[model samples]
Target: MLISGIHSRPKYAGLRVDRSGTHHIILSDTPRDIARMVEGLEPAPGPTEVWTVVGACTVTAAEERGPDGSVVRRAFRSRPLMFDMLGHRLARESMGLRLYAIGEEAFLWDVAALARSFGVDGDEIQLDHAGSERRRVFCVHCRAMTENVRTNIVACVGCGAHLTVRDHFSKRLAAFMGVQADAEVRGDLPPVEEIFR
Candidate 1:
C-alpha cells in the first residue's frame, strides 16, 4: 500500500505454487516477469500451463517445456490474442484451476478481472507485481484511460484535463483514478515527475 490511508491501493504478495491445485495457469505480460515466475513452479506436481505476451521476447524450447517435458505453454504475439485464448480456456475447463499472474500492476489486475468474470474466486488467484511501475490511469472527467502513465500529473487523453493520479484503484477498471489536477486554478499545476516508474 503506497498511500497510508488508502485501502484501494494494491499490495502484492509474491507468487507461490499452490500445492493442492490439480491444474495451474500462470500468466505474465513480459519476458522478465515470466522468467522470475517460473522458479518455484518449474517441476509442478500437476499439469501446468504458462501464457505470456511474447511481443519482443526470445523464447527457447526448453523454456517452454517442463523439465519432464509435460507442462504445456503458449506464447502470443499480442495481448488481445492471449486474453481471448485465456477466456476460452477458462470457459472450457471446468475444474481444479488455480490462476497466477506476475507482471505490471495493470496486467496483474487485468488478469484478475478476467478471471473474476469467469466465476473465479479471489482466493483462487494470486498476483505478483514485476517489471515497470507505470500505471493505467482513468480520467474521472471523461472516463477515458491513459495507458502507461509514469508521472503524477498527466493530460487526459479524452477531455484534455490535467489529471492528478490518485492512489484509489478500481479492480473493475484495472486502473487508478485521475482527477483534474488544476481544477481549482486554471493554470496552476503540480510539478510532473516520473514517479510511477
Candidate 2:
C-alpha cells in the first residue's frame, strides 16, 4: 500500500502494520490520542510507525490551506498480525540497555528491564535489535544535567539495542521518570552501572 503523507512530521520513521484492511489514517491527533488509536489492538504498546501497505490511501489531516505545506511518505512491508504480536513479546522480554565491552564477543548488559521502560506511541520503538549475526554490541552515550539528562542508545553494526543516553544520562532523570536505572544511580555520586537497573 502506498500512503502519501497528507500531513505528518518534518521527519519520519519506517513501520509495518499486520492488519490487511485497516486504513493508515493520518489525522491531526495528539501523541496521546495516537496511542489510544491502537492501544487495544496490540496488547503491549511497542514503538511503531503507521504506514499504509495494501492500497493507495491518503488521510487529510485537518488544516487550513497553506502554500508551504510539508508531506513525506515511506514504504513499509506488511506482516501478519501474529508477527507484530510476537515482536511485541520478544521486545518486552529481550529489549533495552544492552551493553558490551568495546570488542568483547559476549553481551555485557542483560537488557530485559530496559525494554520494559521504553515505549512507542503506536509507532515503532526507536531501539534497534540483534540481527542474524552476533559480532557487534549496543552502546549508550549519556549527557547529564541538573534538570534533565540526554541519552542516545543504539544497536551496533551487528544489531544490539542501544541505551537511551538522553533519558538515562543521570540518576536524577531516572528517578524523576521512575525508572530502575535512575534509582540505582541516585544512590551513588557517579554511576557504577551505566545502564538503569
Candidate 3:
C-alpha cells in the first residue's frame, strides 16, 4: 500500500506470498562478474531468464550455459539495447518478477530505473557492481547529463562550468546533483581527487 513519503503507488501485495515468477538476470560484459553472477544463481525461486550484454568481448563457455543447462540469452551491443530489452520484458511480464543485475554502477542504475518504471519495487531487485563507481551527473547550469564522471570536480559537458558533484542522488534524474564548483571564487578551484573509485 501507499507508505507516507515513500511510493505513491500501492505496494505489490503478492510480493510476500508469490515467489513463482520468472527470474530475469541481467549481466554486463565483464567476464569475472558474469562468472560470479552465475554462481549466485542458485536458490532462485523459479524459472530464470538470463540476458547478458556482450560488448566487444565474447561470452565464455561457462557464461553461455544457464543455471540448469538452459541457454542464456545474449545481446551483442551496447547498454542501451540491453536496457530496451529489459524494459520490454518488464512490460510484457508485470507480476511476480524479480530482477538480478550485475554490472557497473551506471548500468545497474539504468536497469533499476526501468524496473521501477515497470512497478518493480526495490526489494524485488538485486544488484552487484563489477566496476568502479563512475557516476552520472546532471548539471543544473545547462541542464545536461554527464556520464562516467569519476571525480567530485567535473567539467559540465554542456555549460563548461566546473561542477562539484553533490552527494544528493535524484531518483527522477537518475544522476547526482552538480553545482558550480567555483561559485564562491570564480577562479579558485577545489583540489581534485578521484571519487567513486
Candidate 4:
C-alpha cells in the first residue's frame, strides 16, 4: 500500500499557504464558539488583526489573545454601532486582506453581505455560526421580507398566505425561498414543528 493517499492532506492545508496580507477576524458574543473558530488559525507572514463584535459582556483572557497574538475588541450596546463599524472597515479597499466571521446565522449573513458589497472575493472570506438558527425568508406571493423566522411554516404578513419555507437559499435575497404552504390541497395544512430548536 502507498504510504500517502491522494486525499490525506489536512483540512486547513489550503489556508496554510504563505501570503502577504492582513487577517481580519470577526467574532460574536458566544465564547465557546469563538474559541473553537480561533483554535488553530495561526497568523500568516503579514500583519494580523482581530475585531470582535460583542454585546455588553467582558472579554475573556483567551479571547484577548487572538489567533495571531493580540486582539482589538469592541463592544456594542446597539445595532447601529455594529453596522457602522462593519461598514467603516469594509469600505476600505484593500487587496491584501482576509476576512473571517463567526456569529449567529443572521448576523453572519449580514456581515457577509456587507463584505461582498465591498467587492471582497468569496475565496478570501470565511463564515462560521455560533448561536441558534434564525432564518430570513422572502415571500414569493407579496414580495415581503420576514426576519427572525424560526419555523418552517410561516404566515406571510403581506398577502396572508401560509408560506412553506424551502431549503433553497437565495444569495441575492439573503433569505430562504418561501412559497404557499397550502398549495398542495388548498385547505390541508401540515403539522407544525419547531425549527432552530
Q: Which candidate ranks first by lDDT, i.e. highest?
A: 1
Instruction: Write one digit per residue (lDDT tens) for candidate 2, span 1-197.
Output: 11224232112222223333222222111122333333233432223333222222343322332233222222223222323432454465433312111101111111212323444222222211221112122233222211112222222222222222222112212221112223345333223332311
**Which ranges in model 4 have alpha carbons more than 4 Å from their true place?**
1-20, 29-33, 42-49, 55-69, 78-80
In candidate 1, what residue range of length 10 has the lowest lDDT sum? 56-65
Report the candidate with higher lDDT, 3 versus 4.
Answer: 3
- Give the Cα lDDT of each candidate: 0.81, 0.25, 0.65, 0.60
Off by over 4 Å in 2: 1-14, 26-148, 151-188, 191-197
User: lDDT per residue, candidate 1, 9-42, as tens digits?
Assistant: 8898788877677888888786554545555765
Question: Candidate 3 residues 48-124, lDDT tens each?
Answer: 55666666545332335554654365654667667776677778885666676676666766777888888987677
Q: What TM-score would candidate 1 get against the native?
A: 0.89
- Say which prediction, candidate 1 or candidate 4, comes out ahead on lDDT: 1
Q: Evaluate model 4: give its lDDT.
A: 0.60
Comparing 1 and 2 by TM-score, which wins? 1
For model 3, the local distance difference test gives: 0.65
TM-score of each: 0.89, 0.17, 0.75, 0.72
lDDT of 4 by residue, 46-153 (tens): 445455554554533232443445555555644446667667877875676776666555566666677788887567676666567767778988889887788768
Candidate 1 accuracy as lDDT: 0.81
lDDT: worst 10-residue window of model 3: 8-17
